[model samples]
Structure formats: C-alpha cells, structure tokens
Target: MSALARTAARLLLGSAMVGAGVLHLTTQRQEFRAQVPEWFPVDEDLTVLSSGVAEIALGAAFVALPGRKRLIGGLLAAFFVVIFPGNVAQYLESTDAFGLDSDRKRLVRLFFQPLLVLWALYGGGWLRRHPTG
Candidate 1:
C-alpha cells in the first residue's frame, strides 16, 4: 500500500472515530444512552463509555499501525456492526438523543457506517486478497 494513501485514509477514519468517541464519552452521554434500543441489556453509561473508548482505540490504532491495518480494520468493522442498532434507533426515532444535529443528519450517518465497513475491509487487506483492482 502507498504510505501516503494509507496515512490519509487512516487519518480521515481516525478523526471520525476519535470525534465520535469524544462525543459519546462526554457530551452525548444522555443522548446516546437514550438511543440504546430497549432490547439491549447493557447499562447506558457502560455502553456509551465502552463504545467511545473502543472507537478512539480502533480509530487511533488504524492510523498509528499500518502494518496492523488488517487487524484494526477487521476490529473496526465488527464495531460498526455492533453499533448498527444505534443508527437504526436514530433513524426510527428521528431524534438526537445524543447527537448535536438533526434526524436527517443521523440518517445520513446510517449510510456512512456501511462505507466504514467497506473501508475496513479494504484496509484490512481483504480487498487486496480478493483482487478486484
């Protein structure tokens, strides 16, 4: 992989997660907690705190360790799947229970999560192995 491209993508992806983690960790606690679906059993604080911490770690690691990109990306993809419900909850509720913006924006975020999955797949070398490029 080109170092520059990897670096750029990593930075971009990292910033996103870092920002989100910070939001979830601090300002958006109540909002995020409220957004948790009724089906989930975890406590709001632990869920929010753990999720935020994971995002920051995965995001930062993706940038800091290119050689381990595949591992980090895979982990992040799993995280994306784990958080899919939150996105769905946001869409279903049309509320900013933990966000700073509108429902429309939250819907947009739902779409973006898939791209992150794909990015993670690519970053992790799954794409390279398949050889479509």
Candidate 2:
C-alpha cells in the first residue's frame, strides 16, 4: 500500500476502535457484558469496562502516535486475539448480542477476527519489510 493508503487505513481503524470503545463504555455495556464467557473468572461488568478502556486507549494511541504504530498495532492485534474466545463462546453457547442472534451470524463473525489482526498489522507497517507507507 502507498503511504496515503496505509495512513488512511490506520485512521479508519483507529476511528472505528474509538467508536466501538465508546459504545462499550456507554449504550452497549450490557451487550458487551453479555458476550463475556460464563466460565471466565472475571466479573462481567469489570471485564466490559476494562476492555472498553483498553479499546479507547489503544485506539487513540493508534491514531495519535504514528511513531508507535508497530507497538500499538501489535497490542491491538493481541487484543483482538484475546477477545476471540468471547466471540467463540457467544457462538458455542448460543448467546445473543450485537445482532448476532443466530449460530450462523456468530460463526460468521468469528471469521472477521483474523482480518482485524491483519488489518492492524498492515496499518502498522508490519506487513512490509521496510515500510515506505
């Protein structure tokens, strides 16, 4: 990707993360809580709130700290990986949230996780050996 394209992608992803983080902390708190795995040890509300904060911080950093894009992108990728199980649990246990009210919907959503990881990596210039973008 060209420098402009990579920057655009990074900004778009950053903006999306911020928006989702805001939703997690506000109107969608319950929805996010619902996605937490029942077997996980953390309290649902705490998990939701903490993750929301994390998303916000990571998102903002990704946008505002281009110098740290590699680190932040890796962190963002890890965050997505960490949350994959919740998405899996939502599918396996048939938990409904975020309009993923069916097994098919939930299952399909799972596929997007890897794409997110790749997107972060690309935006961070990890996909390039010596990124000009």
Quote the positional error of residue 57 for candidate 1 in Å.
Answer: 1.4
Model 2 vs. true fold: TM? 0.95
Please give, for residues 1-133, the per-residue lDDT of candidate 1 as tens digits.
6656655776788778889889888887777787777667898789889988998888888878888888888898899898898778777866565452686887888888798888777666655534386
- Error (Å) of candidate 2 at residue 63 is 0.4
lDDT of 2: 0.92
* lDDT score for candidate 1 against the true structure: 0.79
State TM-scores per candidate: 0.78, 0.95
C-alpha lDDT of residue 1 in model 1: 65
Candidate 1 colliding pairs: 31-97, 31-98, 70-124
Query: Cα deviation of 60 in candidate 2 (Å)?
Result: 0.2
Query: Number of the top candidate by TM-score?
Result: 2
